[model samples]
Target chain A: PGLQMSQQQINPTRILVLLNMVTKDDLTDSDEYADILDDIREECRKYGNVESLQIPRPLPDLDVPGVGKVFVEFSSVDSAMTAAKAIGGRTFAGRVTISSYLDESKYFAGQFQ
Target chain B: EPQEGKRRKRSRFGEENIAERNLIGAQTVLPSNMTPLQQQCYILHLRIEDANMRLRTGRFGYSDDPSKRSPSPEPVYNGEGKRLNTREYRYRKKYEDDRHEAIQEMIKLNPNYHVPPDYRPPVQKLED
Candidate 1:
């Protein structure tokens, strides 16, 4: 079972999904949110060109999907994969970040909530 | 009486299963393309993550005592070079000192583990 789980690694894609990097409170504050986005972009751009970046913010009285998660779309799969390896397990906002590649189609369909 | 025994056995098995999962989760296989140095760094990264998990879940010593944990390090400015207020600084500082300590321990474990270069150095610090 452990072997199977290890083998189930997701394929590399142009979009990288980062988890555990932010909290709900961080996203709610407008200034903090912008700061986080800039911080992530500056860090990610070191690996390659970042085409688009998104950090889903929480909504009032609504359960927003993907809140506190960061999505970064790079110009190429290689860049995305590189960024994933570099950023994974790295600390952001004092939290260990877990990163994975996301499918381009799903990213485009706005399903990344 | 037999049913009670079976229920207790199942619960024990469940606990063991969870422990096994955690073991596997902590030492995931390193990527094949990495060099020996990169692999060592990756393992250190895993150690850092494990330490963070322990601190977060309060599984170990210092984690159990909130007052014993190290105070927050000085706040670094944001990407745009703006300083963060005290409240914001403390809020972001949580777990940072712990993470830094873990990284230091990891470096001690493997002297070959090269620390990644800091891409964003604090501009204010440099100016000072």
Candidate 2:
């Protein structure tokens, strides 16, 4: 699939992660949010070579925008799993409601195959 | 009388029943005489299938076809800057105001101005 491969080319293989979208009390710029993604990318790089990382930002219109959510992406299945296992539900910005994600369908579907 | 091309049948059992038995499995039709393991497996499969069909459609949304993962972040009054540091509010406010006005201009020129909600700018809702 072009979508999957392009993301992979940017950074091959991907596991999706959902994280706390709590705004930092310190960052202040369009680029500042970009920095959060960069931090996530750096964290991902710890487990293995990271090709790319994405964090989904919610719209400002949604009254609940500040803590809406963010998505973290990883390059390897194993790395993503490790990241999810090691850090899911860990505190972020003094909040502990964050979540780790995975490509669940791919893993679950494989069970039947 | 046997129909043409029909196999001779000395027993009560026949081919059509065999086909149905193959399709639905023999124990379904012959439940009265099922082995315990066969009955248990059949029951379990039925229960599992019932559970599976109810899986929310959104869960299977990501197809191998690709071209997905697009989330439109609405232009906000310093929303991103608000994330970085709440102080960049004024600059973000000006920028977002400009972005919305630009979108309004496009709406004026293009009859197809009805953008998908996700693609639209964040507008303040007035109280009644």
lDDT of 2 by residue, A3-28 (tens): 01111111212554433234433233
Query: What is the clash count for each candidate, in the order shown?
Result: 0, 5
**Candidate 1 per-residue lDDT over residues A65-109, each given as its tens digit:** 667668899999889888876776455644446666566887888
lDDT of prediction 1: 0.59
Window of ten residues with lowest summed lDDT in model 1 chain A:
A1-10
The per-model DockQ list reads 0.02, 0.01
- In model 2, state the lDDT of residue B92: 43
List model 2 lDDT by residue over B58-124, tens digit each.
1221224323222224545464554533223433443344345545554555555453233346767
Return the TM-scores of chain A for each candidate in numbered order: 0.91, 0.54
Task: Give stretches of model 2 more than 4 Å off.
Answer: A1-13, A21-29, A60-67, A102-113, B1-128
Error of 1 at A12 (Å): 0.9
